[model samples]
Target chain A: MRWFWFDRFTEFESGSHATSVKNVSLAEEQVHDHFPGAGTMPNSLILEGLAQTSGMLVAEYYDFQERVILAKVPRLRFHLRAVPGDTLIYRAKIDSIEESGARVSVTSHRGEELQAEAEIIFAHLDRHAEQRQLFEPNDFAKLLRTFGVFEVGRKPDGSRIRMPAHLAEAEARYRSQAQA
Target chain B: MPTQDEIFHKVQSALVDALGVDEDEVKPEATLVGDLGAESIDFLDIVFRLEKSFDIKIPRGELFPEDILTNADYVVDGKINDAGLEQLKKRMPFADLTGFEKNPAVQDFATMLTVQDMCNYVASKVDGKA
Candidate 1:
């Protein structure tokens, strides 16, 4: 199963970069599992959140046309442990985009305090060669919308980016069905 | 270079995998969303599969030209004028606009996009003609 660590995007720039937020809540199931009463958000989960943030940014470069798998964590540094009620702000910037893969620099913050930083590499998998679909498009689209990828996304020039026509139509259908 | 038939077959397979639709439903004339039940997210999956399959790069807004609607020069009185229509036609040469041209509502543009259109677009890109 695919994992979506981040909650939603607050700022999305197609191809170049993106920013998302994840609220670590006491109610999360993992919190109880990690510690019986402490309820601390694990540092690994924080790294996963950074991965989700940067992964989406890299995927958008191909218009989500390729399978972007996390290849490596060349570097990572954690400054603090997070508890419930802490909001993690993840920012990902493209270091370079290439045909083989992409390199992204990511940092996580907790309200003016640095929580963690990392450099991640993603491999663009050839789905055709694999002959396997990693995600159902409908489910993936809903995930993108739920994360506000299209709602706040923009071009480098600062113009609002339009959601692809097919995605817009699907979102409309989902909305109507949700209302019904 | 892959033949048009190969491209079409690959495109159909991609759509079937991405949208979870039957192979029989992915006909050339079938509308992706209308007939085949593709949602917006499916397009991303389809494009991704196609790019990986064909070993090509598809820029955002190239396969689906939503940016045209945002261009002021193309939209006049809330409708696409001749120039706008021409530009769209050039961008999406595979789409059949016969019915859309008759009515020309902004919504019709997306609705008019068909399975054959995507197949053609991928073919063009693979052939280095796009």
Candidate 2:
């Protein structure tokens, strides 16, 4: 509910797309007992990884007050098992947005391989209320500020990805860090 | 606050609830791989259960070498032996969740677990029939 699984928003574009990453480590307790000798990264968390990443996109669309939960996972598949040391890159492209909830097509990749993919539907809920809240006054500025919308990424060759104009300055700074 | 043994027992019971494996299958000495035959996704579902049950995050990391990850025997061969289990048990931090603010995933690993811990986690996630 708190988007506890993923962190570090590398690329966040307003009104369209987003990308986030979760670094997996071997020291995890689940790794030790998971299979004794063959501790593997769990898929649900990988799904959680994707959900948390995409959820951030949806969460950013609303102000921080709303908690986004996966109402339905219409389609999801695990192509591979991501291990520790693997950084899961979650990318979500918004298919549509409605008043009650929105739909997102999410992809989870471990480097080049598509680790998992899902079509997720998220319902927006108020933090205080038991049921979901229908709407809130739009806050584009707060979404950009809280979600670190300035950070951006590039292709291997160094061309910048598509992003909003306001984030251009932040993008330049991020590119410097990415290069460094 | 639950003592280590109590925590261990609670974890064991949770595994039985989730995975449905016999309690004897999840003893401290049991191997999660050769003894239990859990797949990777099974491990994930189990962790979610443990998190839900104990209210914790299992610290994550890259443990196995890249070449060995997909191999079935690596887990069954006791690659992470009792010595490793002891090291894992020692690493379970009793610190507050606030310590995890630096990295939320760290909360996932607060409890030092044995193969039994993994079993309980796996068991708790499943319908408790396996």
Give the whole-model CA lDDT for all candidates, comma-separated. Answer: 0.81, 0.56
Native contact fraction of candidate 1?
0.00
lDDT per residue, candidate 1, B8-125, as tens digits?
8998888776677889998999998889877654565566567778888888788778788768898877788888889988887867777877777676566778888888788778
Best by lDDT: 1
TM-score of the second chain in candidate 1: 0.89
Q: For candidate 1, give the lDDT of residue A60.
A: 79
lDDT of 2 by residue, A1-180 (tens): 133566667776644677887777778766456667776777787788777667767765553345666776657889987787888888887765534455678998889989889877677653555755432223333344444554563333545433444444455666687899
Off by over 4 Å in 2: A1-3, A126-180, B1-130
Per-residue lDDT over A18-117 for candidate 1, one digit per residue giving the tens place of the 0 to 100 score:
9999998888888767987888888898899999899988887777778888876657899988889989899999866766577678999999999999
Model 2 / residue B9 / CA error / Å: 54
Residue-by-residue lDDT tens digits, candidate 2, B22-91: 8778777554444555443344444444555665544333121222322343333424433333343344
Interface DockQ per candidate: 0.02, 0.02
